[model samples]
Target chain A: MNKSIGFLGPKGTFSHEAVEGYRSGQNKAYELKEYHSIKDVLCALKDGEVDEAIVPIENSLEGAVNVTLDVLAKEEDMFIVDEFIIPVNLNLVAKQGTKAEDIKVLMSHPQPLGQCRNYLNTNFPGVVQLEENSTSKAAQKVVDGDGTCAAITSKIAAKIYGLEVLETNIQDNENNHTRFVIIARSLKAKTGADKTSIVFSTDNKPGSLYRVLDIFSLWDINMTRIESRPSKSALGQYIFFVDIDGHIEDPDVHDALTMVKRKTSFYKFLGSYPAFAGKI
Target chain B: MNKSIGFLGPKGTFSHEAVEGYRSGQNKAYELKEYHSIKDVLCALKDGEVDEAIVPIENSLEGAVNVTLDVLAKEEDMFIVDEFIIPVNLNLVAKQGTKAEDIKVLMSHPQPLGQCRNYLNTNFPGVVQLEENSTSKAAQKVVDGDGTCAAITSKIAAKIYGLEVLETNIQDNENNHTRFVIIARSLKAKTGADKTSIVFSTDNKPGSLYRVLDIFSLWDINMTRIESRPSKSALGQYIFFVDIDGHIEDPDVHDALTMVKRKTSFYKFLGSYPAFAGKI
Candidate 1:
């Protein structure tokens, strides 16, 4: 594998924070590659410009990131090889001397707005609002502020751009965690916390969904998450994405997948990688 | 039954559009009412405040509106009656003198971002962004801009505040459709194109999911959408909320539900409402 890995960014993003966490986890050698979009990063991987990409898969609060799921449903080769969670904390930042009281407009991404709806509705009652591309972009606007503006962003953003933090931990939920999945064209070294992700389309009959589950049950393999996304081909057919404990090599897990393959019209192993500890 | 209408605001919102849509479709004499939150609206119906409420279920470009699903999964004695696909045209509104060139910030709800992702990505590449509670709230901020700021909102919003339309049809997908459902505490007065929604939890055993589906097949019912949310109970168990063609009262749909009931540990009929009709 290459030493460099691409991450989603224009910098100072939670995606960037996830990249930071991944890099810090690697106590060995590596260089960081960054791209402004998930597609761009995924493309770079396709071109062999990078070894892998870290894509945000889900948030505890928002459920699955459908964009990643949609893209994954099509790409046949990429496997989700590792997973990580990043605790997000955003601040209201602005150009130096833009005091909280003087702030006339506040901006952030839509997800952050909903996450911090409680803060904005209560503390900043009747305050003028705005939306930006990414929280980091919001941070950039704070620097370019003609005054009268503030941004909901990470503290790292404020420090990186010389802005001041007006508020802290502004999201509505205290236990906010976003799950990120590391994807590559091939498998990783397989750590002990391993879990296999697979996608399949089953026949539209009674006990069809149950019959697939029977494999996991009989094998005593536990599933962590199961998501249903439209197959996009026909109206009624669907693709089920499930993550389960154990590796592809494990006899019980292999047997379950083989059994499911026999019963379902279609099935594919998405990846086998270490799962995050205890967020389920 | 009396109407228990719902809009997403303390008093004003685009949900009001869906409410008006429902009003126009039903007999003109049917009474209409409102609520502050979607959950509150569902509660009003469950606790018997009103018969049915209008709620936004999904958006064409944005996919599912997760909040509606989250609330519906838990609420008792309710199902979608009729679905309206409301065509949306977002206009960038500004205070009278604010020029498109002078506007430094743009604001709206997250819905608009994905709606107009391409437009913003191309034309407004570096503009400052902000997300608010609703397009109405964003309109309010632009009205109070007190600076060079604008909000992407509805034409009605511009009319309500006497603002200028700086931009129009700004959504990424020109055919932006928001599907709003008329929900009630009991089965609706069947309008012909009825669809039934139900949630069920089967034993967490292999073949359990498949067996449940065999019931749907036995009756030859068409399932349009199937989604899974966390059981939020013990781990490894999942509750599937399914939408299928035919009202529960129909012979085949009736037989399907009856057989499904026997196989699942639990089942609940959310409601039998008119099938969702995409924008006409």
Candidate 2:
């Protein structure tokens, strides 16, 4: 039976591309499904409408995608079972024969517009920018609208929407990449090279967080990343999302988290899964 | 002589309101100027065009404003001198005589749209949502266009744009607030009740960040908040922004920072300023 994988999409988004790339890596058959929003994808996973959901967790340029982080924090049923990194190469796509200079209005989702800020400022100095609901919608609008409009979207979108790429890698930074996480209802069996993600909030004390970090240090487990999101209960209170470079099934990791868990009022084990590095 | 303050605006933005609130608190007469973007506001400060720039640093619901954090990280000449907390009360403002049931579309900046998601979803499930460049722009568009549209903006914006407040405090969370920071070319003289903000990065070795936090614990300094933004140099690399309770001139804070400065590859003392607490 083919497994069902859900991702944020209108068929040509970066999330859709990441899902396709993940499907190819598994060497297993899967039925691809797309949701209109990040929340929709997670809700689909929770409601069993899909077996798994792949969503962008962080971007090198944009930092964390808050909606995904907040949803993962709130939805106790979902677990991150895998990770993928895709180099974000934004392209300036337009209808065929449309010259870059002739483009009076540029369009994209707010994020791409930001990532490509330097490029846009330098090239299209006085061009009007219009925000679309999604990058795919931006690409669609360029094709459906007049010749004097262009979109900053994916090359995949250019192909899917039958548009021509007027420019490639239009993003300001070459290192721009997005980290996507594969979420599922169950934890995967530990692969030797894996990472674990956990969310917890420390007690309202000065040294509470330092004490937690001390446990990781004592166990010699390397923490890959740490991000603080508001607890929403009050100002200055935060829930920390920590990624460590070992599976929970590992004895050292288990010992570290056990002690760390004891120190926090809220502790959630978000699962250990194979970690992906390098560009797609 | 009148001092000048810069803020993000098309006029009637939350940033504009924040500047007004800050001015009243200071009990001083100053000329207020509006800029097109956060960068413009900072640039105005750096160029000596404005005495100071006040911009939103973070939101209770939406994490850190990356552009503001990144700008602070990159611009060594600018410093955060003070902070203001403003409760974000999003209002559904429309042209006069527009009925809630007759509204076919809602408009706002993406941030407010997300903040008001639950309210929008429940009340106008089928209504079309539009994104404007700013919340103030959304209000202006509603007044300039058809009556069957509304905007999620501040009451100040509705009043300024000559729109009617169809619904008040329409945001999903009552506790939603934005933390705005006053940025200037020089740090403020330390107040007794003050907070210090600093940004730093540790060596890539394991336990490096833990060691830095250990120093804070050793000094008994209370860390009010901590945030990690990608250094933009590489994947998995991060620059940490930390807020601690105490003026930098405080002996304990100075001692801790002195030791911290020695340990990090990069350290920036953002500034010491009187911290604001309680609601505006």
Candidate 3:
């Protein structure tokens, strides 16, 4: 069967890169669909228009992507079947023959601009920063605009828009990477080495989350990630999205999740997939 | 003394509203200055250009503003001396005499647009969405553009920019509120009912964060908030930012914090402030 994957895209985004990387890794033929927003990507998955949706969930520099986490928490049917991490390599790109000194306006999405702040501050100094809807849009802007503009975007973005890379890997952090997750209607068959993701709201008591984490400690499961997002009910209320290093089929993992469900007011099984080791 | 406050602004943003609310609540005259971003707000505070800075730190729907959290985590001298929760009432505004039916383009900062997603999807259908640098900038865009353009922004922004309100409180969630924090160089004198905010990164051992929270449980301190941000050193490493229901002057809070500081590999004192109850 031909699998289909949906991603938040404009042909040359990091999301596109993630899907491409995943597709090549599997060496399988698949159809790729692009959506403008993370919400749309999830909606397509829920509607079964695609077999799986790959969306960014976390960045080393930017932390958790709230839209993805919130959607996962709210959407009961969707499950994360796998995860991917892509090293973000932001390039300063512009139209061909645009001199570096002539560029007065820097453009990109907020995150990439933020990640490259130090580079911008030191290099551009007082250049006017114009934020576009996306990095690809920024690259498109550079293509459309006069020689005074440059965009900090992906190499793929430059290739798509036929822009010239003035500088490569311009992000301040050399170790910057973004974590993406593959979401589907059902979980993949658990391998021995797997990671389980879940979201749960603790009982409204002091140290409720601490007590929940105690269960994982008792089971000796290593947690890979823990993020607390607002439950949207009140100011301090939070639903925890956690990824633990064990498959649901494992007895220890199953027991730990069962204990967590018993202790919390809300419990959601987000799914188990092969554990993502540092690279894609 | 002429006290001054810096905020993220283009004259009429929520940051401007926050400063206004803080100023009127104090009933003291203070010079107000506006900056383009939270980083600038913090820099002004750090450089003593402003007596303090008031920037949105968290939103009920949007979660913690990562820019604010990361800055609070990174900047050593700055402390969160106060907190304010403003109920976010996003309004659909346009030029005078412009009707809702005539509106074709909707502009605003991404967060406000996200908060009002349901309202926008239902009312506007497929209206072209525009992203501006700030909500106030969105209002300015509507003012600068044709009558068909409308902006999703604050009531204050509408008033400041002379845009007529087409609809008020357009946010999908009535409980939508943004939590703003006042940053200063030194802590305010601790009140009896106060909260202390601290950031700590645990040792990379198994169940590390759980063990740190256990100390808070042992002290019987009621924690008001807890968040984990990327330590920025690596992908999996995280720095836990915690707010507990007590003043650092209190013995229990002091002891718990002392233990937390001892347990963690890196620890930073964010500051102690009066506990925020609903309104500022």
> Which model scores highest in lDDT?
2
TM-score of each: 0.73, 0.96, 0.95
Worst 10 residues of 1 chain B by lDDT: B229-238
Local error of candidate 2 at B184, Å?
Answer: 0.8
> Candidate 2: where is the Cα deviation over 4 Å?
A101-104, A125-128, A277-280, B100-105, B125-128, B277-280
Query: Global lDDT for candidate 1?
Result: 0.74
Scored against the native two-chain complex, candidate 1 gets a DockQ of: 0.26
A1-280 per-residue lDDT for model 3 (tens digits): 7989999878888888988988877767989999877788999999989989999998898788877898899888899998888899999999999988999889887678879988987898767676555688788878889889999999989988999999999998888998899999987897788889999999778878888888998999998789999888877899999999989999999999999999999999999998776543
Per-residue lDDT for A1-280 in model 2, tens only? 8999998888898988889888989978999998877888898999999999999998888788888888888888789999999888999999999987799889887778889987887898757677665789888888889899999999999999999998899988898888999999999998899999999999988889889999999999999999999887766789999999999989999999999889999999998999895554
Encode model 1's per-residue lDDT on B1-280: one tens digit a residue.
4444656653335677767776776675455666645656666777776766777776656666776777787666566667776777777789987777787777777777656766875777667666666777777777777858888887877888778887788876555667787776555577778888888888876556667776786677777667775464433456778888888878899989999888998788778877656434
Model 2 pairs whose backbones collide: none
Task: Give me the candidate number with maximum DockQ.
Answer: 2
Model 3 chain A lDDT-worst window of ten: A125-134
| Ranking 2 against 3 by DockQ, winner | 2
TM-score of chain B of 2: 0.94
In model 2, state the lDDT of residue A254.
96
After superposition, the stretches of candidate 3 with alpha carbons farther than 4 Å from their true spots are A100-105, A121-133, A146-148, A278-280, B99-105, B124-130, B277-280
Q: On residues A24-130, what C-alpha lDDT tens digit does candidate 1 reach at each position?
A: 88676657787766656777887888888888877655666776776777677888988888877767788877776777878775556656766876777667666
Which pairs of residues clash in candidate 3, taking residues 3 or more apart in a chain or in different chains? none
Q: TM-score of the A chain in candidate 3?
A: 0.94
TM-score of chain B of each: 0.85, 0.94, 0.94
